[model samples]
Target: MTDQSKHEVQFFTLHGKRRAYVKAGEGPVLLLLHGLACDHRTWLPVIDELAKKYTVIAPDLLGHGVSDKPRADYTLGGYANGMRDLLTVLGIDKVTVVGHSFGGGVAMQFAYQFPERTQRMMLVATGGLGPEVTPLIKFIQAPGWFPAMGVLTLPGIRHVETLALRSAAAYGGGPLRKYTRDLAEVADILESWKDRRTRFAIRHLVRAVIDWRGQIVTMSDRAYLTEAIPMAVVWGREDQVIPVRHASNAAALAPELRVEVMADSGHFPHKDHPEQFARILDDFIVTTEPATYNRARFRRMLRSGMARADTTLASVDTALTTA
Candidate 1:
């Protein structure tokens, strides 16, 4: 039997693209999804630990890491369906899906579209919960923004960031300012921007759900729909990107959602507090009951949604016909 915890990158042809992912262990399946402009590397710390008792599969999404970047749909639904196809090919019938940030949106869509295949769903510092997000993320369509960022991603990236930090510190801006200026977030952003395909893909990905103001897409409206799904919402109190308040807001939307706020952590709680994250995940999997997919119940939900849509469409059609 394989150790499951320690593993290397593997490839499988997904949608005619050479997709990269890491698979380990052999038990119940666990699918890990990463955030925007990120890949499977984001969950490096916690993957091994979780793999100890469960089969872990982490993919590089469609365009982010070493995966092929095709000019295609970047919507949550598209990504969700892509994952379903990938898993089907891999012979994974069901999985406990865990997602972080942008990946959280994909996780929810996965449960929504293929409830039968999702054993449970967990969101970490997820997006699509609220309208608010960090200013850093709302960098779309700003005048001169592309040029400025283009310069930053150039060679000597560290020198530029370092000199700026030193200048701030020398000007008596204090260590706090220097530390704030130098964060891993920038490094992560640069990682994707290093390649032209990834850079374009990241922009497309960000634009799909985010705007200059903040996140444009939201799951709050549908959060209540997950009542039948065993769900958990984990966030860092110090999350620098999405607000932790959204966690509570999401719980209110679905009272049954298990909410966990990792104190003394940031946006990347799984990276900052891997042990705690692993334990929380393990507990959730062990304690909560895996959802039983009932086709009748699912059909009812779909009908409910269609009924609402029909009402709106009827109003429009009636008005147009009268006119």
Candidate 2:
């Protein structure tokens, strides 16, 4: 409702299942992915700016927003596959992927599994690469937590959802006062929250996280950095959730990777600094070579490098123990 003239909400089916997405602008394709407990609306601020120069495709990942939520396994691989199907349905052979938080992990999987199909990737406050997850996230991801949160259905669920959204505004590293006053926005968020499937999908994500530990998937940082795909990483300097240390490791993984640290921002840099985020992405797209982005070779090199790095780290640990 914030003058969304540039965006048109649309829906399409990937493999006979319906999914909803917001399309805006008319230049090159740029797919936007949101984090957990969020839908396409999370990118509203950033999309407003990005639509000016790029054809932005912000989708409600299968179970998130207006999309069909099947009671099936919602692994990270499943999310990546769903994206691949969505792109194929939309006739998008190649695209620039911009992902935030959990979406960042999915974007990495997409690039790793289908590297040639990705033009470039920008990760913002991404997961998977970092070892430090916040205590709040750990609490939410704890087993059997969904049933506890289900108390929202008792009454005044809208009010409860509004409080949750407002609380999340703090996670954005911005003041929560202004966002809480928007009653209509809070109402929409509550409506989305009413979905039972969303809770199930979140639980599935928890299991996936446990499974992903010390395991290589399509979205690992090693894959993103070593892959021939041009990549950049943006982090909120004040990020309490993922922390800036992860950004440092990401840079080490890919020395050539462009890294930007946004001041006074939190996990959601796009929302906190839309103009700056857009400018960084636009510059990367313009300066990077599209043809050199190869998928298979990148995976091979990344895997080899990861093995070597692991051995080196192990040796360092042994030396410290002996000392």
Instruction: Show where candidate 1 strays beyond 4 Å.
Output: 1-6, 141-145, 162-182, 302-323
lDDT by residue for model 1 over 177-286, one digit each (tens)? 42343255555566447576776677777888887767777665465468778999999887778888888667656788899998867678897789999999999999
Please give me the total number of clashing residue pairs in predicted model 2: 0
Taking all chains together, the TM-score of candidate 1 against the true structure is 0.85
Instruction: Provide the lDDT at 108 for model 2.
Output: 84
Any idea what lDDT model 2 has?
Answer: 0.70
Backbone clashes, candidate 1: 1
Number of the predicted model whose TM-score against the real structure is largest: 1
For candidate 2, lDDT tens digit of each residue in 1-323?
A: 12243456689866677788998888889999888667788788878678888888899887777787777657777888888888888888889998888888888888767777888889988876644565655655666567766776445865676667655553533464333333334345455555677767766665566332221232332443544778889988877666666776666556778899998676777777888888888899999976355447665777787776665655433332232
Each prediction's whole-model lDDT (CA) = 0.78, 0.70
Residue 27 lDDT (model 1): 90
